[model samples]
Target: MKRAKLVIGLLGIMLFLAACGNLNSSSMSSSGTNGSKGTQLTGQSTDSNYEGVIENGKYVTSKSRGVSNTQDAGNQLNLKSFEKGLLNVSQQEFSTNKYAFREGQILTKKVVSNWLARESKSNADGLNPKDNGSTSATKRNPIYLQQLEEQDYMIQKNNKLSLGGITIGLGINSVDYYKKTQYGATYETKISKAEAEKQGKAIANKVLMRLRQYDSLKNVPIVIALYRQASDDSLVGGNFFAYSVNKNGTTKVKSWEKLNQKSYVFPIADSQTSPNTNDTTSFDNFKNEVEDFFPNLSGVTAQAQYTNNQLDGMNVNITTQFYSQTEIISFTQFLQTAAQKYLPAKVPIDIQVSSTEGVQSFLSRSENGKKFTTHVFNSY
Candidate 1:
């Protein structure tokens, strides 16, 4: 009888262990934590959802962290503009006052690479169209898709952080550049605005469907924006053309809202006319005054942003040959006065004064502000 009881106890223990193993496997599969580094969260209040969850006194980072995930390493300007522009676009749907920000934890590097590749027999997961044996730019199919970026939002409930929303930025190529043969001249394939919009929307729909397959993302609200990337030789980055929002548990994007946004470099090129004449004149006046004040300046230029054909903001970069601290300070003060007097008072303006050595001073004014705030960097 004693031997039989011992046997029964051993069998019961074996059954319990096996059951626990199954439970762990199920949890891993559902949470999508298999081989993931996992997130770190500190159970502390951030005072506001916009501030996001705090981890070790800092905002929580994504499971797949760092800048290695971003594509397009050739143009640093486009990369910076693309990332910042996406954040601003996201603010329209996921307001900072309500939602907390988090770097994307979903869509790993491997997943993104697959989605960016051309579809073929072996790679059914690829999103790009398969290559046909065509050398002509007019007949050849362009790589419409360029880069993918993801941002996640979180909401705190019952002292635990949960995924509240997500935003994805699809960088579509306006011009596809490639070489047909080894050591051959490069060719350019231009994609029209209408065609880009159509392809972007289609790709967005497919992305939504794939995302819904994951249990964690099935019911999460997602905002997807279509960004038209600037050409390789473009001086500035392109703007987002449209966006769509998919509500919880929905896999399809019903409709898209158009965005009327544009960016222009100061002193409009001879080939391209200014969109806003008054704004252009104001900037030109401001430029002339600053240049007159500092004759030893290397160059002065500005990048302006427009929304609905109205000036939204301007960033001025002043390159100087002066090195004296006093000279830098005086120029910065003069820039402030000139900017206020000549530049539009309705929009924010940022001025950076620099030399070959590095940044010398900075000046800025808030929208409709009466005064400018000045800061001069100190060298050790």
Candidate 2:
């Protein structure tokens, strides 16, 4: 992370990504307005392709990259600390102290509630957290501490994170409208139910690893796991993805891929040869395939692990606590600008995140028995 003036450097990255050439795919290759490197950030809209908060009921800006720059940028949380970038307004008020967190930094904070520590420990269990007889298992009681210690380590790193993903498929038996009968229909969608989670955690890890590449950026990161669930959060089968299973146990994605790989570009689809799903499907085969050979994923307890353990790193202070969301609606462009406007200028690196399809649109159009598959999540 070299010093280039945070604002200008971020702008340079956006511009750079935009002009780098064809995006290499239908979605990437398409031309967009607000060109900011890969961000493709845009402004107020009159275009049909765009859809932020409508001015008169129509999109306010062009459908550039991320989301148009009007709405909130990324899923922002309450800031509590900073070791890397500047904390936004919302983050500063989330916790008791700014120095309370960072990537890999752990704490036994004073109990916010009796169930609070219990939940964090339950999340720490990862796959083995529960017993077969119960719907859930008992969780460890986390220590309630007023203070914490920090530990640091060094490792080889890369700033660039490249991502490629396939849609998640949940094979099921469904009705065949075309055949006018019940049939074994495999649906082909942009992102699968299971794949959305897989790719989300993977993408988070990829970006975190890229951030870890720099010695100057020793600040811990707040792993914000989310989904592109259409605006209606309830419609999603799973609200937000929380954590990735790693060697130690349930932890933030940053902890999962830490020291293991610099970047990961993978797919959501279990196999290139697998087929999609349809209306009548039971999701037995597809779910099994994804579950049997999937990465350690954060089902529901991901947020707790991230909030308590990995969100706070050793040297960097990422005390901010933002919850997850389904999509980056209007502010896609604004966020890119913000990214351009306020990235770590001294320690700048490009991060690209691509879902096979935008999270919002995937659910809006694919409900009512329709299936979606193949999602690509990338960070550059």
Candidate 3:
């Protein structure tokens, strides 16, 4: 009886060992404590749903603490591999921005493709500047609100006012739908104070982004830089207050002028002189703006062009906004890539994104940080 009992106990132990041995080797290799160095997922993958999906490549640890068998299947959504070249924006937020360009929204690959491959470049939408029913003012933004209102009314009614003094009517719809909701594919993207605290990082970094080092990482604190639009200096300076907050939650007070685009020199400081820095290069690298940055620009060439005054108009409008939305989108992607490349198979990472540009009720119709609209109406 004793010998039989011993044999049974040994058999049970053997079965457990065999089960452990049967686990998928690759899965286990990239799993828990068993994963190798570079093979493990990084902190970025903490949010991955498939994190730690398997051990030894064939077994998964169930939420109930039981072991289940699974394949070494890779990402289910990594569908971009086979589909190369240009792709269609299948989603609304993506597609709308594609066919029609908007301010503040980051341009995606699909949007760029659609823009270049635009099927219709014709201004036949019945709203052309040359048309009888177009805004008459040569000045983009007229000084008087009444003039703007007048132009706005004309645009809605589809009536063209003479460039000099004549009235032409397309009898077209006048009210601009985009005027009401500027945050859509036609509006300037703005974030909220609360949201900025959350996702305004890369932007903040861009404000302080420099080509050289600013400080050591251990002491570096995340920054939230806000660049508000300011009026041009008139006969007298305006009164306004500014504030700077470090990573420790302490805020430094400041009194300064609101810097306008293409006219102001952004202040720069040495890493040792300044506090902790994120190592993001200032717009110096982007002498040309985002809407303007083309496929062929490098540091030396752009500088040469600037000296020669040959840079394009689009390059001139790059501003805080150009980097804000774009950097956020790229940052999220970088985090995901980093996580997948560094951490274990099962480690979890959750991202909480917030920004002044967070979802909102209204949007601005701005181009390169300026509000602009073109209404063309032709009456035969």
Full-model lDDT for every candidate: 0.74, 0.23, 0.21
TM-score of each candidate structure, all chains considered together: 0.83, 0.20, 0.15
Query: Runs in model 3 with CA error above 4 Å?
Result: 1-222, 228-247, 251-380
| Candidate 2 per-residue lDDT over residues 1-380, each given as its tens digit | 11111121212121212221111222321223323244211221211111111122222231221111112321122112211112121122222111111122121122111211112344531211122332111222111111111112112123211211101111110110111126644221234445444544544443344334444333433333232322111111112223222222212353421211011111122542212132002123322332343233122100110122221111111111122222332223333333333222222122222233333211111111122121222235
Q: List model 1 lDDT by residue over 273-312, tens digit each.
A: 8979998899889888888887788788888888899888
Candidate 1: TM-score? Answer: 0.83
Winning model by lDDT = 1
Query: Per model, how many backbone clashes are there?
Result: 0, 77, 53
Off by over 4 Å in 1: 1-72, 182-184
Where does candidate 2 have its weakest 10-residue lDDT segment? 165-174
lDDT of 3: 0.21
